[model samples]
Target: MNPRGTRLLAGRSLLVLFMAATAVPFLSLFTTALAPQGSTPHGISWPSHPHWHNFVDAFNAADLLPLLYSSCLIVLGVVPICLALCAAAGYGLAVLGFPGARLVFGLLLLGLTVPIESLITPLYYQMQSLGLLNTRWALILPLIGLFMPFGVFWMRTFFQSLPKELLEAASVDGAGPWAAFRRVHLPLAAPAVSSLAILLFLWTWNQFILSIAMIDDPSKRTAAGALGAFQGHYGTNVVLLSAGALLIMLPTIAVFVVFQRHFVKALLQGAVKG
Candidate 1:
């Protein structure tokens, strides 16, 4: 065979390999979601019957709207407080020269090592004491506080890397500390904050255990928590399970599509500065 023919065959093989590697996982997950639950012992595969109805049924079988409400409520509970606190804490850590500022920053970083699973028991008791369990506030308040630690750390790193000149220039123009942050810092930090918001929002939205434990009422459940209903109702209906997984993935997909531009911008900004 000619060398050119060999080269053409090798290139075709390489292209096929790349496409399979990239497409297979997503395609497998999607096929599994649509597949009848027990079709293959444990491996992901396509359904024998394209159970499109399962997607619609999954929505109908549960009080999905309330679940969606609870999910939104969780996002609502966690995102704003975390964002505000991070903005404030990050700004201070990046700008202020307080005594023990590094120490404070170190303590905040320590909070990251404390796993959510480890704190659940103690947090449960605390929520019980406040009579907040089974309510939206129960989930919101602790998540906000617990989530703050990471938010501060993330924002601080991003903030510290920002041009110090911008803040100083604002100060020179007679803007107060708060005014400078409102007028200048936030606009520039928009990319970082938006990226941070995307991560935190996804975390809060997909949280299952906390939502399950804190809110005893099944209706007061996040979309992840609602998956329990799928297991309960469908049990062995593999197709339904597959569809439900796909359904669960959609909201997060939408969120990323929206905020993805900001996240990309943030990375570009951070990379250039570094």
Candidate 2:
């Protein structure tokens, strides 16, 4: 076999290994969740009598309904606003060639280095000062701010990869900057926007720390945040805890499964452009 064929075989084998590695934990969780309640199941053994009711019990015990609603509310509030702001900022920085854009972009890039853990205390105080604590706004507002750096960067990179002639062509046809952005670039950016939306949704949904720090009520907290309290209450019950975990994970998994095509397409587009 040639060197290229050998490398292909090796890569395929590694990919299979990685897929299995990623799947094992979730497979274990599923089997444990199905095991008899209050019973400790080892490894990934199938239960002789699956306790499917564990899921229902876990849902009720964790009060997941309200938590799910809160998560959806936060996601709805964050993703669209973040996308709009990022897209506009990206367009200005990458395409408009405005003065001092480099300095502004560099400042925003610094935000990517600041850890969320470090901001929690300051954010808590800020939210309190604004009287937004314990409300959905506590999560919604901070998340938008926190997500800006990476979101802007993502959209900026995509915009920068496009040919500048596109905008010039739009200008030749009597379109102004806003018109060019709205009619030309925005349409071309659909894949990038869709991909960014998926990422924002996942990040917002799985935001555990901010959700826990900002909101006192478990019901108002994001699904991932509520898991801490749920585990605290049901920590001893491995079966029920597993069930609740799977329930918390369901939304993210469902979302990825639904929009995975867009995510993959965006990634492929980036690779090809690069």
Candidate 3:
């Protein structure tokens, strides 16, 4: 029983405790989803006769296919464009050091302080005036804008961490800024970009407020947003509601499970670099 061994044991115990805390809600949801329809199940008791078909019923009732399509469309529209814009802006600010770069970066930082909830009313009206309301564009366009502040900040921080010698060497080889960026930095930035893409995808996919506020049609809203309507319709049917909730959560969970390594790598990279 060395001191180090005691600390390791303590840390492992804490980790297991936190893991169980994280898993309890999902376990409860799963059990409730399997409960008999229209029956309010207490706690996390397993149903004697689990209604597996509730998932199918929830899917149909929620019309999840169109919602899924809309979410995918919005993600496609938002992630790539946001990544490009943020990366370029970050490069310009960190590497190029253009005039007023600090001022511009400061403004982006200020934007991060602004709450999304505060913009909802004005955004709704703006979308209505522009005739983008009730369409996927409403969600797509606003998300790109909303994500910019954090995206640019993340990219800028990563770019600043890169060795300046790399850029200098590229220049010595007669490479232009665009060439250096495309050939040298972009490849190095894959992990950061992949991590950012995962974050934007998760945010866009789970965007409930703007999806419901801007888009009137349930099918056009994000899967998480459409859940509000599903909840409204099946609020009394706790089983169906739970099933629908789990269905909506499936894609995000799957994505995180798949790309979690990249996400963790980027985070660790930042910590080490910082």
Best candidate according to TM-score: 2
Give TM per candidate: 0.85, 0.97, 0.96
Question: How many clashes in candidate 1?
Answer: 7
**Better candidate number, 1 or 3, judged by lDDT:** 3
Which lDDT tens digits does candidate 1 get at residues 17-72? Answer: 99899778767767766654456425555556776666787777765777787788
Q: Lowest summed lDDT over 10 consecutive residues: which window, candidate 1?
A: 36-45
Compute the lDDT of residue 8 as modeled in candidate 1.
98
lDDT tens digits, residue span 1-274, model 2 = 9999999999999999999999999999999999988798999999888889999999999989988998998899999999999999999998998999999999999999999999999999999999999999999999999999998888888888899999999999999999999999889899999999999999999999999999999888899999999999999999999999999999999999999999999888771243
Candidate models: Cα lDDT each: 0.80, 0.93, 0.91
- Tell me the deviation in Å of residue 62 in model 3: 1.0
Give model 2 RMSD, 1 decimal: 1.2
Q: List the residue pairs that clash in candidate 1.
A: 33-242, 33-243, 35-239, 36-238, 36-239, 37-238, 37-239
Cα error, residue 244 of model 1, in Å, equals 1.6
Worst 10 residues of 2 by lDDT: 265-274
Global Cα RMSD, each model: 4.8, 1.2, 1.5
Give the local distance difference test score of model 1.
0.80
Tell me the tens digit of each residue's lDDT in model 3 across 200-255. Answer: 99999999988989988988889999999988988999989999999999999999
